[model samples]
Target: MDSNNTNVKSNADTILIVDDHPSNLQVLFALLESYGFRVLAVQNGENALKIANSILPDLILLDILMPGIDGFEVCRLLKAKSETQHIPVIFLTALSETVNKVKGFEMGGIDYVTKPIEHRELLARIQTHLTLKKMSFSLACQNEKLQQEVYARTRVERQQALVGKITEKIRDSLDETQILQTVTEELVKVLNTDSCQIELYDEKLTMATVVYEYIKEDSKEAPREHLRYHGKVRQVIEPIYQQLLKKIPLQFVSTSLDSKYTKLACPIFENGGSKGILGNLWLLKPSEAVFEELEVQLVQQVASQCAIAIRQARLYEASQQQVKELEKLNRLKDDFLKTISHELRSPMSSMQLAMQTLEKLLQSDYPHYKSPKFARVLEIFTSSARRHNRLIENLLMLCYLDVKSEVFTSELINLQIFIPEIIQSFSARIQQQQQHLLIDLPEHLPLLSSHAASLEHIVVELLTNACKYTGPGETIGLQARVTDQAIELSVTNSGVVIPEKEQHRIFDQFYRIPDNDPWQHGGTGLGLTLVKKMVEVIGASLELESYKGQTKFTIKLPNHHCTLS
Candidate 1:
């Protein structure tokens, strides 16, 4: 072939030219070469087919008359084959007859040129076919891209459906084991993996256990091979676990699997305050098998739901244990209180009987019965004993209320009559304090439905507190009235004001107000606490307000009516 290899603007569009005449090849090659085309020239049809198949050129120029296979035959063979069929073909012929030109077009020749060729016509025809070829190639590429996008969107929809199933499973129950098992099973199906395992870590991070595991029955790998409990396999998980400790998500090619298999893990996280990675969702696959990015992302999403379920179940179990412990302690305290109270009462009764006998003897036969000095000592002894007895009774009452062991039977008590009786019981103390006592008693105060014994104790505690706290000549008042909603009873004292912060704890057993010294007040501190519990048992509310040098304790009895009698 005649050759002139000169620099032409390179579009790199390769055109394969076939003709029996070397002159024709030379002229056409030079004409196409100067036009920025990459030209490959062959003088015979056999070589044309070979080069076309090998190079798969963008366009082919073939002469109709050749030795072994004619140009029509060459185009026919190219069209028949899969690899070279897309190439555009143009036939060259010297014959001007319409029949031969028609024959060329029928044989899959895209265009034809009369030979002793017009260089310009040949060039123009070549340019037209090359443009058409480029446009066809571009269209094919766009079609392929569109198909890929459709496939991607379909995959995402399927993955989302799988996520919906996972969400449903979580909403069904908070059982940790069930949630993990369902997760592993779904992972195997979605990932098309050989096996899956969910490993859990202890709070201290000192230990890891496989909480759930799965293996495909048809998988060739043995169950033991997939287990991480053994030798070097555990080391593979150590780094992933460390990543989880930092709350960072990670995925890496795993070497723990046999060379024939591949493994991947995604961290599972806990729900609440300190969000630590609880464990990992581990997936295994045959080495030749492929796991796409979409599948990996699906596992991560499902893993999140698993974390929440596990955390909830753990917290619930811990709360149950705490509740049981509190109940046991409460029961033990109730038994101890009851036993001690019974033991204390027997000695107290004997002391009271002995004191009475001594008093009887003094009055009847003792010489000091008429002496003032003996009389004073006996009065002091009797006072101390009575106070001690009252303390013991308060303690026993507290024990009953603490465990809800006392059954309260409500009775109708007329407050008009009841209030005066309670005040009369403290008559000696009221006279000795020399404090002005004011009673605003109503004639028709509403009757209270309550346990009478408990109500009596409540009233006495409030009255005693009022008497003790008020200074000499300060006003101490007891008031009773009926309200639209309930019965209101209050005791007020003018001298002492309770501090704000101490009021909250005033109703706690044995909690005396700070600096209200026991020596001065002479109270066991159980008085107010006992009062509160008894008030609650009878369905009443107690309130205390202290401000501007005055304090009032009020009790509102519920409106539940008992028999008027």
Candidate 2:
């Protein structure tokens, strides 16, 4: 035992000896062990093959006359096995026959030795074969390393080529979806992955959207599509995302090895300032493969290209949005000017006719000046002038409201006291139109904090709309109430049912309801738009509900500003 232990510790290379003769096995084991070779001795070919497989000896010595199996057959079996095929085999025989020697060599033996072995000659042959085995191993290792390097270089070149093509695609198009789809398809081929996906994130980075996905044609799993990952998927991916968010250029194997899939994530950064993570370029494969350094580098480069494309696409979209807004603004300006021209001409023509009538009245005899018809001409002149002046005043107020100036002064207004004065101003017109005005006012109502002029304008526009839409003898209703969180003021008119579709656009400048008789309600169409702007400036919400011959406009104000007492 001690001798064997010493033999094993003395040399790193191992030798296996197979012989049926105990004497031959002992002789070979002792001879090899003495020369600092670790040796295993067996009495038959069966044990020899077993030990060879278990310990993987560097060389084997076989005696031809074995009981169960002979040296020739043993050598054939060893040569066939992948693990033992590289081991050098030498045959031991006492036969002087040249035919046996030739047969031994035919069975994969390197050399044969006679039974009366010369120890020095035997040692020299063993040494020679062991040295050859050592050289063979070193050469094999070098060849393997060279092949790997060549393969890696070729792979990198392929990846770089793919990147160039994708870069060209990105440059040629500003379509984000198309670029991402191309990236996933190309990446799946380059990485030789079963599946690939590119994940995009919202500006908040709280959600991950799978923008593009690709599954191999031969894959058994159903194909996945662009989807947002949430719930369990989010929980699993969030930690990885956070790690990459902090160290953007990170590449590490995930710790969760139990998962069936392996993933590589690369951050996509915007052009400037950590605009947060735009998204991730994710490569997925079966867990068998560890992510390689070359793959990491390729994904990083691809991610950068994708980031540039995404930014360009986003910038283009923003420019398009701005262009649309400008076009809409220009259209609004043109409409405003046209409406102003028509509104002004009507009032101007009326004033001109009144002036011509006054001129005739003045040229007539002195007695005619005191006539009732002459007096009626003066009244007509006065009414036309007042109407013209009111239109000018409304236009000026509109101009003032459009400017972002400190024109609005908020104050505590008691609707119970302030509303009646407005109603009184419109009373004569309401009576002339023969419409019934119903005021549903709550006693001891709360005082509202708001811009007085803005509020008055809003209410006046609502009442005027109610009167204009209602026929003679139709009822106009005004109601006010206080809720737990807000003050609600509503004005309702019952007569005409405004079409549901036109209700939304009623607050737009120069947008009037298309009525059969538009001439009956003469308006510049700026009244509701001006009122809407005033309400917005004063921090109130206005909602209009028109259905079944009743139209109601409600204004809601925050209760915090209202004096409940």
Candidate 3:
């Protein structure tokens, strides 16, 4: 109804009025409302205390002399309470005695006012007390914030100190595993954690491997094997270690919220990457008052030490691994060169002699071969040249797919057309040896996502393998089907069953099954390896199935990633 009511806001500071006088309450309520403040009027001290606690007014105006629980006692109770103690109380009474003023102050009154008040002085006093109350609250809030900041800084510093100490040990010590192991121990002993372990993240960063450490309560021994787990735990935790790897700090759960919870992870980081985590068990949340200087500093020191040590271990592992890898590479090159030289020389010499013979015969004889005998001899020479060329081409392609490139152009195409044509192309040779070829690919299907050249090459390689192994008159079968998110294609051949041990290594480049038996075919011994490389390039995987009378080379291509041009 008034200008004061028009400006009444939700954020307006609330004031409680305590006086036994009804007329005074009414007058003050209107006056307080006019000034844009919320007013709660109470007739007695008892009601004043009750409403002040319930409503949580920003300020309280009390009349010193009252009927039962007077203003003095009411103010005392308000100040004693944990919740209401923050409310600023000002006494308003007719008693202008210095004794009364002093007594009011002693009873926790922030200020005093004389009754039968002039409206202007009353408003002024109210305004002054409210300003003081606001300032007091602002100061309290700032103080709390400053304390939090100090605690956080101290925590960081403590962690840094811990890092420095561990870094000294890591740099000086030679045992990498022990250093990592001790970090867990230090976290448990120093941080007072119930359980802790440093887990290794896989290359994908989507799984955690508890390297050498198990979560068993009784044994408390690091496992010889790597224990792995995934899902939500990995999602939340891996980022922390990833940060640690960059030497960046990614600290989680610095307090008691996870105290009673079974699992807790505190990651240690350096230079913005995750090296590893500082694992712990039975760790309780820090005391709220943990900023009691010493505790805060200690917590930060521990965190720092753990981070530095993890980083140091990571660096050491990387350097040592590089050295060992280079040594291994040296050995691989030494052996590969020897084998390639021997393999290449045999084909080169044979082809060179045949070319020399053809050159001599062409130079001396007529250009047109009219005789049937001449044409038969020419066919044998041409067949020999083609076989040698095929071997060389397969070898080079294998090397390229294995060592030179990885990317494959994605597309959807018909395996049916390609597979059948490929079989038809090999039909003459199959018939020459009285061998049977089987084709089982379905007609026009969903355009499967894959690479055409790589897939065709894999099929050719598998068929070549089948031709080499199976005897004359045996059956070679080509089959294709879609399974789950993959397209499965298989090339099956009868006879030449792969042994168990050799089956595992069949895809290794130039790994031949040693045999003096004429039934066993021989080559540069890299067909299956080439097939694997091509299969992989096309986003498909290859597997072998071999038993007594049947052998199949199956390729499983991931179908979900397919896209159309």
| Per-model lDDT | 0.79, 0.77, 0.68
Candidate 1 positional error at 358, Å: 3.3
Lowest lDDT block of 10, candidate 3:
223-232
In TM-score terms, candidate 2 sits at 0.50
Model 1 agreement with the true structure over 58-120: per-residue lDDT tens digits: 998899988889888998899999999889998889989999888887888899988779988
Task: TM-score winner between 1 and 2, please give it.
Answer: 1
- Per-candidate TM-scores read 0.74, 0.50, 0.41
Tell me the deviation in Å of residue 422 in model 2. 69
Better of 2 and 3 by lDDT: 2
The per-residue C-alpha lDDT of model 1 at residue 241 equals 65
Highest-lDDT candidate: 1
Winning model by TM-score: 1
- Ranking of candidates on TM-score, top first: 1, 2, 3
Q: How accurate is candidate 1 locally (lDDT)?
A: 0.79
Ranking by lDDT: 1, 2, 3
